[model samples]
Target: MVIFMLVKDVMKKPITVKDNDDLTEVIKLFREKRISGAPVLNDDGELVGIISESDIIKTLTTHDEDLNLILPSPLDLIELPLKTAIKIEEFKEDLKKALKTKVKDVMTKDVVVAKPDMTINDAAKLMVEHKIKRLPVVDEDGKLIGIITRGDIIEALV
Candidate 1:
């Protein structure tokens, strides 16, 4: 009989971020580690949220303007120079806001998590159902211990 894998058996030690961490620092971590996302923890070491690349992109794109300038479209083609200038200005403002923002401001607070004893099959199902790439593994006390990703599951299966 094939024994099913458990989350703890496949999960890796998580790279986590504090709830109050600066978004700039988090971005640096993402680049340096080459990871797309991480689990967010509170001062008490409880998993409170998850931050992903999509979250960062969403935060940066939350501007008041329509921001849907399609280049080469008839209207934009007629005012190329003016449109270019306006886009550059908007880019500067958005960059400033992104740099100044905090992780807590953009993190998804309602994080879905996995238990150490959960079957890998169940964990994979959870990830698919939630449309998430990873799940923070928590112990009975609700403290983050490890994280399981789609890659981890794939590696185990193969």
Candidate 2:
């Protein structure tokens, strides 16, 4: 039986980010909220792109002739920085890097946005093919309305 439903009907409220936002801030939100991704919005609040943990991971470790140049090893990351040890200059530089990186830097700019009137099967198929856990639901105007995740699909299935 065909599940004839629009993505808007099942999508969750979106957690969004601006095009000029610091990716580091986004990362914190992801960790606290346990979400894999979020939508990126332009100044006019249009759907620009999507950013996922995998995207951030790519930035941290790019393939360089079979060598990886990752910053702050997993063990070192666990050691929380003391208040005094935190240098303002260093923090500022990191923030600058994140802002300059732009949403386009790590976001999936070639997006496969879901329209309100797509079948559940079609959406699921796209997600599977793209290896993405979520799909942003948008209107014809390219304005984001919500998002649908694998969890949402599973909940509907059961």
Candidate 3:
């Protein structure tokens, strides 16, 4: 028998970032939590935007023309020799500037969300349609409550 499940049944408590949070702090949070993205919330705890690893990488690579030349593509940095690509001091200074940059500055503002009552299958279809890996689950009032990931649906099926 196939069972339909609601988002609340499989969603995990959201790991959120504040709009005013420093990019450096956000990056640290992502690293520590091993998350690729997070919902950006305002002072009232309302979801305003979303930030992902791609955004951070874009910010780092595009901020300076020198940096952009060194790491033309996001993956190029991994293959390029770091010492030849950028000086340690320059990289550190860039990181410091990045740390001061607010999450709101780099977050994707036009966000797609899902209600807690939405079915897992429906959510999965929405994700596929939008080409997203996850969806933030919101309450009737539109407050972020949890997040459902692609992994969640697969786990539910198992």
Q: Which candidate comes out best when scored by lDDT?
A: 1
How well does each candidate superpose onto the true structure, as a TM-score? 0.83, 0.72, 0.79
**lDDT tens digits, residue span 60-138, model 1:** 7754454455456787667877867888898898888787788889899999999999999999999999999999999
Clash statistics: count for each candidate: 0, 0, 0
Candidate 2 error regions (>4 Å):
62-100
Question: How close is each model in CA RMSD to the real structure?
Answer: 3.4, 7.7, 6.8
Q: Tell how far residue 66 is off in model 1, in angstroms.
A: 7.3
Candidate 1: residue pairs that collide:
none
Q: Global lDDT for candidate 3? A: 0.86
Give the per-residue lDDT digits (tens) of candidate 2, residues 89-149: 5556665665456666789888787887887778999999988888899888878888999
Rank candidates by lDDT, best first.
Answer: 1, 3, 2
Residue 101 lDDT in candidate 3: 90
Model 3 misplaced stretches (Cα beyond 4 Å): 1-3, 63-92
Candidate lDDT values, in order: 0.88, 0.77, 0.86
Query: With candidate 3 superimposed using the best TM-score fit, by how many Å does residue 41's alpha carbon deviate from the native?
Result: 0.8
Q: Report clash pairs, candidate 2.
A: none
lDDT of 2 at 128: 96
User: lDDT by residue for model 3 over 1-158, one digit each (tens)?
Assistant: 22578999999999999999998899899999999999999998889999998888888873444444533676765645774445666878877787799899999998889998888989999999988888999999888999998988899997
